[model samples]
Target: MRITALAAALVLVVASAAPASAAAADGTYEYKLLAKAKPDECFNGIGVPYPAGPPCAEGQPKVNQAYVWGLTRVGTDIWFGTGTNNNCLTTGATLGATKPVLNADYVCEYAESQMVKNDPKIPPEIGDVRPPEVWVYDSRSQRNTDLSAQIDKRSTDDKYRRDHTIGLRAAGNFKDVVLLAGPTAEGYVNVFAFDARSHRYLGSTTYTGYGNVRTFLQYDNALYLGVGVGVNGGDGGAVLRWTGSLKSPFSFDVVASLPVQAADLSAYDGRIAATSWPAEGSVNAPEKMAGVWISPLLADGLPGLTTEDAAGWKQVWNARQYEPDKVTAATYGMGGVASYGGYLWWGSMHVPMKATKVHQKVYPQDTDEAKQAQVKGTQRATSIFRGKNLGTPDQKIELVYGAVALPVYDGVTKTWSNKTTNYTPLFGKSGFDNPYNNYTWRMVVTDGKLFVGTMDWSYVVQDIVSGGSQVAAPDPVGYGGDLWMFTDPEQKATAVNTTGMGNYLNYGIRNMIVDGTGGLYLGMANPMNLRTDLTDDVPEGGWELIHLTKSCK
Candidate 1:
């Protein structure tokens, strides 16, 4: 009898193991390659494509633009925004010129000036701005339409003479209209309206304060905008509420302000939650580090009763309180935030290229201290946190996803404590076990599941190599942005798709939206014009729009 029971147990073990292995082999989701943008697509209806050579020299047959940064769904059609390869404009120019320009401060400006001088058709006021293109894909008809010209016409600013609009930063459906925010030169954020029913372009409103509008959310019948002060000078960041009729679309009210840049804003549990960039300095900094704040719920249960002051908001989480001993200071600027699974989910931002010493004095990149700082910055994995009962004072917050267990530092004691405890990483340590995938660009909840999109810097490392930088290459596993879905609350994260949805040039999944019909759309970020060297499949590097759906067994 004992032998027979043992034999049955062995049989059960084998049967269970076989199914688990097969499931692993089958993968959780099937990926379909949807569409690819070409180099000529950037020039479509805009301006003539620059002749091959010199500054505009081709990496492939045709230099491709990168990023389908903006994505939104209206009815059955999906609208995506594509960004130009600003790197092709100048060797030093970066996307949105985010980096601090040291040597030639205006390389992109200089290149634009030269392009205007050469091209007869191109106006000097517009310069050589290769504005982002807008495309609409009709899922019902399976057709695509280029709406770049219509969007451009509505955003034209004769005062600035800079008609070239960058990629759409945020998009949403509000009151039967699709609102799109596009930023141009000199801290101008242009908001455009489109009739979703007729797919027609409406008028646009241009705001002067914020350089870029990063995120948008609709609550309490009002559209809230999160604006960032990029390279342009401003009084940090502000949250603006749009409360106007169709006839007067430009009316806005400033609701809140922060000392640093406002990274993102989201509506959660009848209140608005916001995150900001880190302030300067280390131990005794004048301004506080990045933090999560919730506005007091008004009588209408909306988040706009107070102005931009301490008394108007309640602080929830601060990076300094969670800073690890490995780094001098924690600059935990929050990224995407959303309400999911009975909790508010938020992600951290840790871009190594943007990492710098936050305490004491600025350290030079060549010094050992600076190099260690860079490693420490990269080691600061993007963490995912969840808070339950967000608005109430009894709210609880916990780290749901992260890899490293950094030792907590005690300011008064001046010692490292809790080295072995409380530093639990839900995800395995080391950049979620993929070093290059550090920044969580966006997060969204759909069909009762949480999906996270990341920005992998492995391609940026390769771009550095192609541009003759001394930094070593990153690991192969870290090449592309990864999409992770949290379905079973108890199970590990399921990787839906990883190969940048078939475009290897895609380094970041900047935006994602649900199609309302059981489908998810992803926007790719491939800034440095990448082409597939192995095959001629895509000779020019361009951004791609990818759609994901569950496969039938």
Candidate 2:
């Protein structure tokens, strides 16, 4: 969707994920945007569509890529704030906000990422939502405020750890569209629901699902959260639910708990959809069912789970049996979530599953060229794969659910081609941030289309962009690191379109939120101040606040 000069005054949004078109922007990094936003683009329980890009407007560089993290959207306008201070940039020098971007522009400017000081040193099993109050590039109000405090006291509690920002979501009409963020601790995930009117925290609640809730979704008036429980013998992963009821004196209830060995997810429909890795693995080994799951969400008050069910949340939906294939074993959600048109969609890291020819002999991907050759007597299953059906039917066949069961993304060709020729964006690190193909961490669908970003991949880019990958900063950088645009109509990955928007936040790109005006906003790491690691420029360096607008002129 491009905005003409006349249209730039407001904001126009379009459907993406269709067979749109565009050329890869020149490799040289130049930030671009089309500023136009719709009214109900935020928290309306509806979505706006985005056409493929290549035609968005080009703009002057916006702040030269501050290491910003966590993006939050206020109304149609976008708000971005940085995270924790490095407290040690160079030679152990402390780095915190010296005076952040209050409100920068209608065009995309300001900085975000913040280096966290008291960031919890938790296990990799949980998700952290710290560095409260994702900043709004205050426009008319001017001077950014810690709006998060209105929602979380943690804003003052320096001990609180807030990492990335997911965008603003509608909780209910009366209340503000819920903006989701995380706090670090042993087993607590904070949800600071805000009131767009008062522009303050409506009510802040934390869930003790015993697991670290990764992402969230609103459906059927319920808040579904993806909580990950370590599989190394502890509680496995599960999806916890919360009803959007402000009253009733209830803490929070576990809606439908979907359990698995290692899982991370975002809520959609009755179930929480996510990406899994290996389709099949030893009963003990984890698979990548990063596929999709639609667990039951309290069917109209079907004896909703009680505290008694907490311990038994394990019985809710054994995530291990989630997708017959169990594809996402190790990667654990490294992908995002998307629910559109009654269908759930996700992408996997394609962590190969070792299969024998016997498995291939009995069952072929219908497009197995070698199998086809065997029919012509040109090849034999014995030569192709002669062994045993390593993966059971349920696991293997279940993995192949889509317009085309066989999914193949050729990083070399930069294309996603499936068995039946269905296509989608072929995004990767080569064209992406480097080190790894920009394997998107999460995805969001607006008006029948999809958008995605890489969490860890962006960290890789930060390494190179910062000068070199010398572990200059901490590895696997912060959230919402990089952003990648794509069209996922039929599910096969297709056109790979990185916008005129460069890596505004050299940090990890986290949640993707569409605003009331259809502008795309992200919650990421606090814009970084390269005090210790890169030793780049600041005033120019450090975290930031970034906004993306697409205009076709």
Candidate 3:
């Protein structure tokens, strides 16, 4: 009766007690696949493209995984930037190598046996290799154009040409100029601009102080960028603002320096609100959890608001302040934030790595250390919170989804106070309550409805253990990217579409944009070509763009 690794994985999926839908029906909406990336072309230091043949052939260039990380719309054209995976090109690496062997997940690993044929100096690390691609899709003519070559031409240096841009992380539109956040050769996040009117690459501004700019928001006529990685000499994330014109040589000024990584930014009630990843510290490090902070509304008019003006900001919510009593250590990070339905809504980031029985052998359930691990691993439910009237001290912060109640810190009592209430679950009631679906990756408010895109890792888990078999009884909760719409404030969120536009290979919808006609544009995130085993379903294991158009009901 001893179960194998593959069989154990299958049992976990079947035990979920949920049923999978075969296909989408006619009444709701329709999905159309727009574009997909070809196999990654090996290039030299001078931008010389090498064909995928003979010596350079590594089983059809295995790392064809791509994700649309940046999306923006200008006029009738939708622009997107993609990030490709090179983890599959490693020498002797296994997926989830850091985890225990029995409970190890190889969903993120690639089985390709491709060797680095051209470059010897390129390390096997993630960011050190692979270039990102940019594309433009015209809604009028329904044409998609690959603009990677034009973006490649912007850099003439051997370092940039060899390493390639690390992919466009975030995008924003200021007037008629489109700004994209990407990495330069010097290990800094640079802002590249394109004239939407003329359709030409304007120029790029190098932010040597920051490593990666991952999020952007335009408020009041200025552009605000979120820094994920810090400068070379210093550490910690920052929120920077570009107040200069849309021309070359942009001026960037640091507004605030955060203790952890800055994840997303949004404009709420004439103020800029930011969310951050948890800081690196001990398991019970109360100050190391993620939180939401907002700047003073009047600070926008300040001519020189720098890091010295940190006192002008206020912290409304911190994840550590809301931890349950049973959970010992939780990595509470915030992902996407939006101002919708008269409230500032934000989603939690709780990724469960090792909560299965195989991991419990390393740390037993009764000990303190085991309690901490279980809290961190098993408490993967992502909670949604909203604050009404953010600027006031007595602002009502309510938990809309996932948890029944959470503990909030009381300064007067100097201890955690339980804020118990009749909390509602958005997807849990519908049987889509897996921890993998907790990543509220992105959100957009369009057509009087709030659209949410989630990163579902159930497919990755199944692919890793089951070797990508559809015949196996599927995870009851299902897998792939999930799109939900909250049209009526009184009603629960409705599932608009799922399984990444019907392509189960697409595990997440990282980027989303709304066209001029209120139609939704979804960008798929399928990295490391995890769907290689399912070649019958997806011929190329790259990312795809899916357009979801609502019919007149």
Candidate 4:
């Protein structure tokens, strides 16, 4: 009788070993990888073939523009993660005309379908899911359906995210040590962990309601500290917490809250630091600015930055006030902060509030000197067709994003100072006049170096005066702000990296993510996802993904 009972117990144990559905296969990739989707053979996502009809017959080849919202390196495979940011392809400058620039940022959402699932609607409810998701490219199978249905599910977070910076720390080449995803528009951040050997999701934790995570950090182990976006724009929100017990599913708790509005958090040497938001209207509405805040790597009440405190704990430095005279805030939605060159940096992104683009832009007739002779022989006239830059550049005045480097030594005292300034312009905005004043939506700089990623393109800058040479309006004198990079220590950046990413629709500058390798992931509205231009496939609506190997290097 004892032997027979033991056999029964063994059977039950074997049955309970069923794999967890949320957890991928033993070798399934998690949040770190870039993989392309399968393409449809006959119906393409482009101008005509998709929703309305195939564009091939109309002389418009169906091409896809891809934009990447974020990147997750799961296993050895690198995934350019993103979702259909908007009906981007269809949202063209003109009502009916498609936006070529935005369209190139990514293949349409419909186009991504063939690559993942064959079912009509996916698990996440196509419209409900968020972009910037992790896809496993290494496990591609001819039967695209081989992947778990999670990729197809729609998102439940806020509609779209304006901030693209995600906090990431690495353990090794294939594993993403930690990924703290904080969307600017919402109050939730998804925590994901990768097991290098197993290549799957080991654990996940979700923290809800933190206003907007302006910035966060994955300190020590599972501990994540988030700051920014006060509650309903109130005084400020608390420094919450999320705990992962290492059990199958995880839970979170609020350890402690602070009175000050912290913007971003910096972690190093087992200690954590942060900056507070200035008065509201100060940058946009200074009356509401909160100032800077700091904390230890281990928050109050929490033992340490560990898997137990996934949500976070209380304040270590408490809240510190900022004096308007000593510090200034950046424009709303135009400011950013980064940790590089051994300090935390903050800056405001500036762009001319005025529209500098003319209805008719001057285009060189041809590269051949002979073909360009029309400029030398023909007498210039002021007619509309005469070809001239009509509008004056708001060059020096392009909107300015406030900036400051944390742990930076003040020039006079040579002490670590957290100063704020209005303007991402490193190459003296006062020096030149550019007809096409490029509005810098996003930028990064440190050690007297700079990198500017604009809504149009990217650029690296050097000497402010030398860089902004005399030139006609459209090609802004300051070498046009592409992805700007300033690696020098003596001054900020004024040049650009020569490499190119798709430019047509550069909206991702307002929404982007950076990886451990300093790769900047941008999302743009793309047309390549449309099956047809007329079928309402969102001819110009999609996303684009660009990989900048290194912003500082």
Best-fitting candidate, scored by TM-score: 3
Q: What is the per-residue lDDT of model 2 for residues 152-205, given as tens digits with 9 covering 90 to 100?
A: 464543224333322221122223444454433444445555555555555555
- In terms of lDDT, model 4 sits at 0.32
Positional deviation of residue 455's Cα in model 3 after best superposition, in angstroms? 0.8
TM-score of each: 0.76, 0.51, 0.78, 0.46
Predicted candidate 1 versus true structure: per-residue lDDT over 14-34, tens digit per residue: 243221110121254555556
Best prediction by lDDT: 3
lDDT of each: 0.58, 0.34, 0.60, 0.32
State how far residue 478 of model 3 sits from its true place (Å).
1.7
True-structure Cα RMSD, model 3: 6.6
Q: With candidate 3 superimposed using the best TM-score fit, by how many Å does residue 491's alpha carbon deviate from the native?
A: 2.3
**Candidate 1 regions off by >4 Å?**
1-26, 41-49, 52-64, 86-129, 152-164, 229-234, 279-288, 298-311, 325-331, 356-361, 365-379, 391-393, 403-422, 463-477, 530-540
Between candidates 2 and 4, the TM-score winner:
2
Q: Per model, state how many residue pairs clash.
A: 2, 134, 0, 135
Shift of residue 147 alpha carbon in model 4, Å: 6.4
